[model samples]
Target: SSLTDKIKLQEEDKSENKKIKSFEELEKETRESSLKTLDDYFKFISELDRNDWFGVFVNAISSRFDPHTNYMAPDDKERFDVSISGKFEGIGARLQKKNDFTEITELISGGPAWRGKELEPGDVILKVAQGDGEPVDISGMRLDNVVKKIKGPKGTEVRLTVKKVDGTIKVISLIRDMVETEETYAKSSVVERNGVKYGIIYLPKFYIDFENKDSRDAGKDVAIEVERLKQQGVSGIIMDVRDNGGGSLKTAVDITGLFIEQGPVVQIKSAGTKKEVLYDRDAKVQWDGPLVVMVNNFSASASEILAAAIQDYKRGIVIGSKQTYGKGTVQNVIDLNQFVRGNTVGDLGALKTTTQKFYRINGGSTQLEGVASDVIMPDRYSHINIGERDLENAMPWSKIDAAPYDTWKKQDNFEKALQNSKSRMALNEHFQLIEKNAKWTKERKDAAVYSLKLDEFKKEQEKIEAESKTFKPITDYQNDLKFKPIPEDEVVMQKDESFKEKRERWFESLSKDIYVEEALNVLDDLQAKPVTKGEINLKKKGVKSK
Candidate 1:
């Protein structure tokens, strides 16, 4: 029976919507089973109008906004509950449709496909098969059905014929496994320059499983990694928290504990409730070394919390854009069946209502005023500004009593060193490139009208290109789509130096990104000061003469 029909029958039983009988009505409605075949499914789909189809899709995915949230339609929920979980598993890769073809956007890092080493981003999957027979072309197929066909039990093999970007085709086989979330653990690396090493820990996301209470969480994993990095003699560490959407709150505090000796990491303030201060255990310090956190506009939720705490306690330098996504509010998933009881309209889907607001240890809410960067850099989002501050229903920025903690002592000549670095960056080739791109982007964004007339549009585009050609190019001269904004490149190397065209030149130039180069330079300056009486001295710098 359709979900709507079930609700209709229940509503008729009690002429009023607020009054639903007892647990029996709820249990009986929830336990209702569906008996339908593949043909029946398609027949039902074919009968639906455009609006109905869209409504069905919306109803199917509505409850998945939260990590633990889910909405199971009758037909789909049956397969998940009755059957095995591993069958809906394959090489564990996230695929997406771009233009008209299915392309691999991200590899599961350590999954079967990643281990095969054949699949990569931008590779188009042309066909799939079970054995060494003819492959089936799955072009123009729906993404869900395509995934369903590819996924199966563990140890089972599947073959994929993929087409490279250069049009070359090859076949590769991979075994399936029930993908585990823990497999995406914290990864760490070290970068060394001029005898000073800085550990780079890239946390993809904060994750914790609710079912397995004993499993090692992200906080515990990060603590272990930090200890290992300290053992390797790293002078400092860069906690790169980019694109991390956030996970368990418990892990957030645990992760913060690694750096902070003891203090409140974050404060939770809600309506008509006592403020709660979540403190780090004063157990031991993993690495209280000089710290720098790298974040972008996409850095959100728990990412903002970690960055805010470090900033509040003056424990680290926050480096990135002007700010991050201001998502300070915390939400609680209230199962409608629990609170609303019998007064719900069908499965009004669990309400993910916002309950509490998170604040930095210093009492500043991270809502609108996302942790500001100490030093801002040129990013694509530099010019295009839009964040939580520019939202309609966004909460106001406020603060409470500040927490007491020793501020991370400013390194001698820190400001002078940063200014000198910025000066050098302004004169850098890559910085100029980004600046030009930003200006051009702003103009395009502010353009009043677009022309469809071929001649007029081409003429305008050519004019823009001619003006841009005067500036020195960054990296190399490539026929990228961005150049199409103007029309042509003028091959003008009148003032600046131009190098011979070599693939290695592009690779080597990008290998030392201007932003990363500046970051490394800062790290170098920071490493020169000797640890005397737990205080830094710039004059007695341990400079190595070549």
Candidate 2:
């Protein structure tokens, strides 16, 4: 049987090196790699018989309505809660299947894997062993199975034999612990440049635990960070929401409140209802200074809401990609079991239904068009089609009457500031190289297929590798600004040396970031403008106001 063949190929000792020559050998090797841990499939399949297949059937039907809507079983709902909260019992590392290897994408801060200091991004996990048991070779195994093998009860140990990017292998033992998704939270850094303090807050997502009373929204965290930055006397703040896939609609509105005084944050149009304008009732502005919000094609929902609100109100200059991810529609999960009045045969799952669509205060829906950047910059995904329109069965965009909102008084010269940024970005060599790299990357992605012929393949790979070596200068770009982590995080950084090293590398990358540099330039231009525009405060917290 085919299963027997798969099992034989999968169970075979992968350590036995063989020089593959012909196409037939290559095909065999691929199958071996793809089916390396074949028993996992059988084990997983055998356990899935009890799952509610009807839920999947209904979900398929529901997906046709919109991509955001879905069906969730009880377990799925539980897992979804865990994902949103960023709290789960595991080794604490994000993994993705790449080139037939489950590679570590990112290590969570202060987690078990981070504490172990052995596992790292780009390390390919080859095998997983549970508490001194037989190490299960996970090479080419399904990601689902790999996760199952790795995730066990808290306090249990899981050993992973990982092949590093350098091609060396090492077995690392990590104890499973509760890794609270600290990465999802807001983190700030003070970048001092030319006697000016600029604050940068990186918000990975608009995360909040709706079910847990102890968990706070990301907006609260952002406010705290803003206060800290205010304490440091930052002239401007760069709220980076680059790849943030939005969450917590309430939190998005709350975060926008931090910059502007008060007004309509976002407009919602649910079925059979008038447009609902969510207002920030608090009239006090938290940060009455220049602000720049960073977003990309991956930024969606809550991210788009905040960016769009800031743009509509002319409160801050939106910078980065041409537009954000166009996901304006909202979905609410409903328990399917509630519909069954009588005792059902089994527990039915919940349905995540598209109940509403959000629009900007100025009336344009961010469904398909998203929010356009004020200072558009060249990014890796600028050319790629990765927005709401690109998604299957996405809703069409519509417009409504604009909500009443006042522009930030001090930003009367905002247009000139944008032009100044554009002029500078045009002359920057770093941005030019980035644009070139984006084109090159797209072309490479288009022609990624390799010739199965060994000689031809080897030559092509060599050519690519040689080309890669030429990018040294651009990759090595560094700025004079020294980025310092917030004082609160310093204690944790000191305890975990690896975390500090990771933070150091991140800071170094930020220094090289042309976008951030341009944003800083934009902030400077705003400050350089006429003082008569508005009554703005640019002084430090301790300084006496004139």
Candidate 3:
């Protein structure tokens, strides 16, 4: 059977395979199919014009200076702008290429595709047609070309022929509109454990709108979320920036101010210039209770700055991976068209290049050594080389004079909480398995050579699969904590089923997160005990009493 037919049969509802091919036969078939696909891909690439190749060449040259520096074409620049702003005029369905077919990975919430409820994730897009026009087959087409065909001006119709996961085929029509990427914004949820409520704020990026000041930005949105969480009577808050690849620098500083008293947050230095410290001058602390900033290996730039500042001031416990993504340098996207005058060469796109470097208030740069978590957690990527230090042309780590700041002294049990969390991690069965899996993954990565003989390959795969079964419980482990949205979100969820579904999925994931469970435990340990009137009187009299 063809790939499409096989996919239809295998993924159909209540379907089962009638026959199973041997491993060798299946492997041989896959190899031949993949080779033909590769041949087709190269053939398509061979027909590209000079302008397309020029764009690639320009980017290749720009990358030699640094990994972050790049030359974006006109279309690339448009996409970059949409990403930073978190909005775009399109059908709002994210697509990925699977072999020769275009697969819908996600439908932006509240957008046309999602609101229509016709298209869904895992549905294969077979054809696209512009408003009552002839349909064009998208098979074997470049992903970008397919995207171009689907996205159009607002209110315009785009008809897509899709193969549903249940082996059904249908044509869905959607009107393009301004779709907001809700996942890029900050959202909060409340979870209670042991009679105390905790707020979990997930900030995917420090987004900002340069063109419109009134538009929603990360700083404003997160501040609003913090206020909402406070209204829910949360005793502690967890700011989760895990996998956040960073965005606006100003938002990072603004967010840091929410937890701490007015103080220096980060430092910046350009070539041949003295260091300048960015401070959060606002004296109004939003939430003064126990805090935890969660981060992982993918947290970079703005995320690192937030974690580093929190760590420096002892305002919160940094928990998650050993260190972050280590991207301390800043980038500025310069419009290339500004350099040209009265030219007919069309759109020149832009250039994003390294500008300055950022440092923690304590003086150390997060360059090649990202902020170290106070309570390190074991993850599958723990043993992998995935930080700035592993990348070519990455900046080196350095230090400067520490900025003037005061450490948080209100939480006297900070050290105790840190020690308790570390001890818990050391004894956690799930974490132990994660550590073992990480080491095993590293070993497999290192030992890449394998026998080509079918029997030997089958035997090796069987042995590896048997060994991997030991770590299967990691995915099945659940902390069983229930998370609920704030009252405001609950109201919106009542009117929007899609919004409710998205929140439920997030809550389900949080319930299974052991790291979050541990963070809450640390928060529990950090809770201050109520002082008695006698102790207060003794303190007032300047008398030391037990």
Candidate 4:
């Protein structure tokens, strides 16, 4: 009950509801909207059958305990499985239902569509045509129906009328293929500054391919990357989990094992049971050098576990944002069909109920107060209401007995490095603009209801835009890095054309990463500070402005 603290929102008096003076006009519109809402609900109910309502009832009951606990129907279970497997047969682009069209949000690396290079994120799909056949306008269509139209058997072709982010229209054809989500996997690159090389590992998500178990492994892959960096004689390591939406818990524990020699990775406590400490008993440390973990508001669950463990151990400097996403619970999929017997009417799905809560080795639950960052940064989500505390009826934060562990053996100069970085960040113009923009965004969100008149609305919108325009070129920051793919990956990329382009794009992004540059700066300072004989012997790495 105390895993998430409730946010205290300052309430306005009821008198604020009477802002509009025209009561008669409001009453007239309210009746018309009431009928329209009823019509919409009726249409929604008309589309449901027996299983739909059954799933709804179970989910409604499940969600009462917390938001994470929910019942998944048959179709929902299949989709969940697909998401975990990270494999599907489609055009390999993630689509979201925008106002009237399906917008491409992200493209799977090495997929047929990504290799085509004709589509990009923010492009709107207006129509889908199968193999030169008559095109069907998909604007305003249901997302599932639109997906069905775009997907086909392998070897089939689908053409899309795409409205680009620049507002240009183009027709692009792509062959249907089984898409493997390469972006979810761990990738690494080498960055050089001040005569020292740093290894940067960007883990988008702690992905584990369950359907094809042998196909991918997050921990094993990361370990291999660390070994590759070690061969290059890297001075420090930076694990970037900024946007990672966590996945496999087992993988998270295993990945943490790669850092420390042997110790507890995390603690798990099931309801009505004793706590169990998951340990790395093998006494193997993959990268014993200086380490840093980067996280933002979106990093959660398994990501928090790794970051928390590292922080608790003082094994690395945790940077970015006020805190990580506060999700510290584990869920178990319960098959509802198992409970049904004796001529079960139809197929029941499963319930992914929260079964256990986790705790950091230092005894803090990352439920409400996520893993707090040591170095807070100015980011876009800083002013947003998007955390566990913002959720209705979220679990509160709590504490447990601290697990038996020792601080990192190489702990040295962390405080010095943190203070030095804070000083540098205070003078950074880009970060200053970010903080200003965050204030502006909060003010706009607080305004809430806006003027309905076209002229007034336009004036307000233009004013907001003009104020925000001062912070353009947020992506202009760049730092030089001698990035090289692992020897084994270079060999594979040589043969795979799509993989080569994807790797190139990844390198380009790294060049423009302001966060990565700052991380290296911290690592450099940590190394420069005096420490235990072997902890840090190098000089301060240089930072150059373009």
All candidates' TM-scores?
A: 0.60, 0.77, 0.78, 0.77
Number of the predicted model whose lDDT against the real structure is largest: 3
Model 4 over residues 1-546: C-alpha lDDT tens digits?
000000001122245554433445544654564465456546656887887777768866876788788888788888777766677888887776655669875577667777787886557787688998845667656566678888778899999977654333467999999887776788888867766788999887787766677877898889888989899889899999885758888888998989998888899898789999998887878888789999988778899999999999898999998898798888899887888677457767788988889899999998978898989887866876555666556777888888899888675678888987787678776777678766765666466476766457656655765766565656455565656776777898999987787888888777866677778888887784433433332223322335
User: Residue pairs in steric clash, candidate 1?
Assistant: none
Best by TM-score: 3
Model 3, span 113-166: residue lDDT tens:
877868865578987889988566678887778898998899999999887643
Which one wins by TM-score: 2 or 3?
Answer: 3
Candidate 2 Cα lDDT to native: 0.77
lDDT of each: 0.61, 0.77, 0.81, 0.76
The clash count for each model shown is 0, 0, 0, 7
lDDT of 2 by residue, 72-185 (tens): 877778777666557788988878666567978567765788767678655779889898875677765656568888998899999887765433346689899888765667
Which residue pairs clash within candidate 4? Answer: 2-396, 2-397, 3-396, 3-397, 4-395, 4-396, 4-397
Candidate 1 per-residue lDDT over residues 64-146, each given as its tens digit: 44222334333344444332222246786767654445777456544677656678655778677786654555665545555
Error of 2 at 328 (Å): 0.7
